[model samples]
Target: MLIAFFTNNYKPFVGGVPIAIENTARMLRRRGHRVLIFAPDYDGDVQDEPDVFRVLSIKNFNNTPFSLPLPLTLRPAYDLDTLSQVDVVHVHHPFLLGMSGLQLARAYNLPVVFTYHTQYEKYIHYLPFPQQMTAELAIRLSTRFANSCDAVIAPSSDIRKTLIERGVQVPVHVLPTGVDLQKFRGGQKDFLRKKFNLSAETQIVLTVSRLAKEKNISFLIRAFVRLCTYNSQAVFVLVGRGDAEDDLKALARDLGIANRVYFAGELVGKELVSAYKGADVFVFASTTETQGLVVLESMACGVPPVVVDAPGVRDFVHPGVNGFMVPEDGEADFAERVLTLLDDEALRKALGAEALKTARRWSLRQTTSKLERIYKSLSAKGQPRGKRERFIMLRELISYQFEKLLEEVDKLF
Candidate 1:
């Protein structure tokens, strides 16, 4: 099967979504499926991945990191002949490229599926519009786009539930963008110790995430500081670089724990593996994640996580088995849980073993095979969404009428 993925960004952009798209595409290709990624060009540096078609885009349109694709320019630049050969269109974002892919899918008479990758409502603060208004608009747009698709893919059951709640009237599949278990499991690296100047006796508590406000990273830092109050030997290693780096560094310095805190900026490949493997336990506080891929990655490296309980994080964290999940309200408890794992070597080892076992279940091979099954099922159905087509058309008509009515009402007022 030839699957074309339309996303806002791709390689060199360090994030979970890109990682998912890249890894999933690679694994699917390995499983005898051709995958092509349609993404905005991040600069002149082209990715080494084969068959990635980059669109012309304007950089730094908003205060956000994502580059906005110039759809008019993109249309001309796209290889429509090659795109027409695609069996399935999978869109990872809800705007720009998403609309373009839907248009392509219609023109080619191909099935288009959408993945609800991010919590758009949470990121509405980036826009200049009113927060509530922007969030509602984003939801409406997401719902309409998702409903138009032949099928919807959710990274976790939690995201699927959100999509359903937001009025996505289509088949939703709860398929996580799985981890590359082998990468984390077998790699050996002495970089973490040498780079950070840490001794064998130092206990490393690692957390890998973008240093963004939405990540609740400040909360993690506070908890880590408290954990240090109990376990002086434990060192906190916060990996990944983002906007909040300076603020987080100041917070650590203010707490007089700067020496104990190591901010390893944006580790990839072997460095990332070393960070996961060198850690005694993984600590995360992000409340906004469709699926915490980093948690699974850490677990695969035989490092159990002590994460604040959120819908996505709960899916992987088992209280006593693989990792401990602290309730969203329990910040102090989160710290204690980290200290517990740091203090008890035997319990940490036990949990790490269980974590590795759990991580094995979410291998990329298994997830890609499941995705292939979804693709085959949709393809075998011929018209793909025959039953839902009429319903979608009717819904669009009603929506059009409602918008017209609202516009006329506004004119009167």
Candidate 2:
């Protein structure tokens, strides 16, 4: 089957969404299916992936890592013969290039499958409009887009429930981006000894996330400070960079644990694997994730995480079996859980072994096969969406594009 993916994020841009797209595309290709990606050009250089069609884009929009694609540039690609034969359209976002893909799917009369990848309402700080207004609009617009599709892929059961509450009438499947288990499980590395001049006896606690406010990173740091009060050898390491880095660093200094905290900004490839494997415990406080890919990665490396009890994280963790889940309101309890693992060698090793076993259940091969089945089932259907439904979807998408154009013009003046 020929499957096409339209996303606002892709390669050369390292983030959760791009990583998910890359993993899904690679796994599908390995399964004897053809996949094409329509994405924004990040570097304006020669294309690395032959199957990807680059749409003209504004790199690093509003000083953020995301690229703003010029949707008009995508029309010429639609004229290509190869694209015309695509069996299904998998859209990874609800706006921008997502709308362009919907237009393409409609013209070709193909099945459209939309994935709910992020909690857009949580990122309203990136928008120029008023917070409440933009957030409400985001929720409403995303729900309308989901309803416009033939089927929706929710990364977690929590997201599916939210969609139903918002009146999404289409078929909703709870499917998440799976972890590449081998990437971390292949080997072990003592990153703490190599990066810092720390001994093997030192207790290492690690967390990987963009140092953004929405991630609740400050909460993690405060919890880490509490752990430091009791364990002198325990050190906290953060493995990502974002706009809030300076503020977070200041917070650490104010709390007097500056020396105990290490900021390992933006690790990728082997460095990331080493960080996950070397740590005694993995900690996460983000409440906005659609799924906990990083937490799963940590588990694959045999690290047990004590994560904040939230919708996405709960799907992967079994309280006594693999990891601990602290309630969102229990910050002190969160620290206590991590301290429990850090101080006890036997219990930590027991949970760490179980974590690797748990991670295997959500491996890439398993998840991609499920995606293939869904595509085949959807493609077997006899007809496209109703004519009236297609017309309404197109009209709404065009109006959205026009409004975005006006905003770009308004910014120029």
Worst 10 residues of 2 by lDDT: 386-395
Model 1 weakest 10-residue run by lDDT: 385-394
lDDT of 2 at 275: 85
Residue 233 of model 2 has an lDDT of 88
* lDDT at position 379, candidate 2: 86
Global fold similarity of model 2 (TM-score) = 0.92
Q: Over 4 Å off in model 1, which ranges?
A: 384-413
Off by over 4 Å in 2: 43-47, 77-79, 384-413
User: How do the residues 100-209 of candidate 2 rate in per-residue lDDT, one tens digit apiece?
Assistant: 77877877778899999998999999877788756766887788888888899998899999999999998899988988876775444676568888887788889999
Which has the greatest lDDT? 2
Each candidate's lDDT (Cα)? 0.82, 0.85
RMSD each, Å? 3.4, 5.1
lDDT of 1: 0.82
Q: Local error of candidate 1 at 36, Å?
A: 1.4
